[model samples]
Target: DHLMLYVTNGMGEGIEASLLTNLAINALRNARRAGIPIADQAALADQAVYAHYRGRCYLSVLLFDFDLTNGRVRVVDAGSPQLLRLRRGVVEHVGFEAQLPLGMFEETDYVAQEFEVEPGDRLLFVSDGVHAVASPKGEAYGEAALARAIQSTRLLPAAEVPRAILRELTGHRGEAMPDDDALVVCLDWRGRPADR
Candidate 1:
């Protein structure tokens, strides 16, 4: 009935980040298991993280709740990248306003925006690290380059889309490892499993 997409900011490193990431994952998992509303899941996780880390660790998350039955998606964006939706060969941002990163404050409420998707639609989620990849000339990879890459590779298999995007990033930034962590995820909607 529900599928979820989750990504955390990889800005933090070492033991503290590992522990904080685990806490966040559990918080979100427990909230969903308890049937918490999609809109409030982030807030619940935020409270748990904040209470535990006390501003020592913060997270920028992109939480997506996918309703397979109805072909709708509810997204809570907390300082993550703008979601890109590809439909009929055209790619565009889904247009949701993002709130502050979780664990930054004592009480923070996250609002989710809902949208309908169809078969053949592809959703892309790129991390800040991906955007921050810099060229030898010190230029960031940026959205314009990412969009162009997506457009060029839209026809590839879903599993290969991320690879292609990474290739694009590498092409721009050269062969060196990026200074920050990079994550690129692509979801191709092909209706429900039963339908398939």
Candidate 2:
């Protein structure tokens, strides 16, 4: 019962570091409230602070919450990445109407969207860093690439799609390490059968 979270911050060193860290913290807090188990909160907080202090402008986070009896995902996007949902071989983006980045407001209310995941359905979340990676020709990875990657890996298990996308990114970017941190999270809901 693990829920995965993928986060990525935009360009510029130390620009959105603090805000991203705060967003991660808020996301974790909200997840915990939803009954997700987060080990070593203090350590994570420390790492978040360090990420901000080190001026890591491009921050990406992939977290898995291994508790999903509730079939809900709590997500907080702080100007990071886009979330895509795949069902019956079609891809759709889950739109976040108007939510501010984490840590920007003290009493910010992050709206959590819930999807009744059916068996064999998959969800893909990735940071802009991945999409921002460009080739020597100055072409971006782009949403089309993301969509193709997801479609190609749709048959595979949830865990493998992220890795596949990473591999694809390498080929597209022609580098092992991307300019910005790239994070990916794939969630597959193998729902339980209804009792007679």
Candidate 3:
């Protein structure tokens, strides 16, 4: 099985989300037709965004195509700073440097890269909102807190990781709402069964 996800923000308040949604779908089609990677899809989306929308927006794309026959997991990602990988109760950064978010450069080329994952591992994807909160004390919740949230819940069920992060974020902010829409996605890899 395979999966693709798109998270976009930093747009002016005029149907930006809708445009990004449409952009993702159309870009996927373009990627398949051109035999390119997700980064190319991002470039396609960027061109579409620049052609129609005139606002600054950040688009983060994550695609993982699992070849169940060989236990190979191909992960393609761009424009996201923080991707957490949980393995055996430990959380580590996936360390993907996004080429650039969509709508930044009209001629930019997005490079979709690949990575491998093991069975029973979890990948946590977050939007910019997770780290964009500024407290009255002027401190951003930051990546350290996010790491802790995942570390603390590494042993728990996969469903609880995002909740714990949000809970911690809210606790740190103490009544300050994030300016952007926040999204969290957790993928748990169970691996292909040998019986198959």
Best candidate according to TM-score = 1
lDDT by residue for model 3 (1-196), tens: 4444554444445686676656755766677567666656666777776666553654555555566665465554555535778888877777755566666667677665667777888888877778767667979877777778888877778787778778777788777666766667777887777884
For residues 1-196, could you state the per-residue lDDT of candidate 1 as single tens digits?
A: 8898887883488987888878888989999999998668889889998998887778888888889898988888887666788899888877778787888888898899888999899988888778778999899988788888899998899899999898778889887767877788898898876744
- For residue 168, what is the lDDT in candidate 1? 78
Q: What are the lDDT scores of the predictions, listed in order?
A: 0.84, 0.61, 0.67
Clashing pairs in 3: none
Between prediction 2 and prediction 3, the one with superior lDDT is 3
- The runs of at least 3 residues in candidate 2 whose Cα sits more than 4 Å from the true structure, single-residue gaps closed, are 1-76
RMSD of each: 2.0, 6.2, 2.9
**Reference-based TM-score, model 3:** 0.80
Residue 122, candidate 1: Cα error in Å is 0.8
TM-score (C-alpha) between model 1 and the true structure: 0.91
Q: Judged by TM-score relative to the true structure, which candidate is superior, 1 or 3?
A: 1
Give a tens-digit lDDT track for model 2, residues 103-172. 3333444344444566777877777777788986779988888889899998887878899998898889
Clashing residue pairs for model 2: 1-66, 1-67, 2-65, 2-66, 3-65
